[model samples]
Target: MKRISTLIAVATLALAGSSFAADRPVHLRGEVTAVGAGDFVVTDRKGTKTTIKLPEQAQVLDVSRSSQAAIQENSYLGIAAAPAPQGKVRAMGVMVFPEAARGLNEGHFPWDLGDRGTMTNATVAKVVKKASATELEMRFGGKAQQVVLDKDTVYGQFVPGKRELIVVGAKVLVIGASAADGATAANAVMVGRDGFLPPI
Candidate 1:
């Protein structure tokens, strides 16, 4: 009876330990409302505010302006566009995902760009520039879509951002762990340069 009791006690302790395991890192996107000594507050699109703590060596990435020339065949991309006439999508913005982010969010779904906007993550099969806008033929999962782009369309690529770039009124997408004090301790923070948001 004592042996059985000992085994049960060990199993119980293991289960209790599992309950305190840290949560998986998640992404948080919002506009910075405040910046403190080692932390900042951001308000998301839904108006929810979250406090995020930055470690001394927190990784920071800056999203800078890019051009269609940067996009090449077989490049993974995420496009936010609105439906155009004849079943086409007119691109409002394009985000070039790095090779490491390939296959992330790999599908087309409704987005929040226009009245009935859509977001597509795919590989660029072809790119043709017209007199006014550039057209991209993108394919993913054996499906295809035509995305139209123009100079007004924002393009963003991530680069290492200096810590000083973290400031009030800046938009950020942070990947990190949630702390017990209701703040997120960031592993990496991506911010837009020159007032643009990180599209990916």
Candidate 2:
């Protein structure tokens, strides 16, 4: 009876922890203001400061400055966009994936950016430059999507990075889980290098 009670108590604690982590998902984009032992502070564009805890196993990716010229035919990309006219999407930001990271999360799904924001991870089939915008025809999971990138679109490329990249004044995009007490813990952190901001 004692062993059974102990097993039940452990199981309940595990379930509670999982539920707490799942209850709140955090996505933050901002500039790092301070880095401390196992935690950091970020201030968003609107000056909202948030403290984020970094776990020992948190994944980090470095984003480097990129331009439209880097987006070529057959290139893989992760694009954050919103629906536009005639069944197309307007690119808000584009992330050029490295060749080794091709086909990562290849799908089109709803995003958290805005009311109608979506994220598409696909391979470029064709590219066309117009007077005011660059158009890309992309394919993923047997579906096609048209994305238009205008002058305001941001671009970056992903590269391997270490925890040392997290420093003051560096731009970052973090995906984390929030506990019931409102404490945020990072699951992944993307840091921009050389003054480049993470585009998405």
| Candidate number of the best TM-score | 2
> Model 1: which ten-residue window has the lowest total lDDT?
8-17
Whole-structure CA lDDT of model 1: 0.72
**For each candidate, what is the lDDT?**
0.72, 0.78
Candidate 2 per-residue C-alpha lDDT over 2-107 given as tens digits, one digit per residue, 9 for 90 to 100: 2333222221111223434455767789999999999999999899999999988676777788988889999988888889999999998888876655665577
Candidate 1 lDDT, tens digit per residue, 1-200? 32333222221111211323664444677898999999888889999988888988566776777877889889888787888877889888787766665665567877655688788888999988789888889998889998888767877776456778889988887766775655577766778887777764
RMSD of 2: 9.5
> In angstroms, how far off is 46's CA in candidate 1?
11
Instruction: For candidate 1, list the clashing residue pairs, or say none.
Output: none
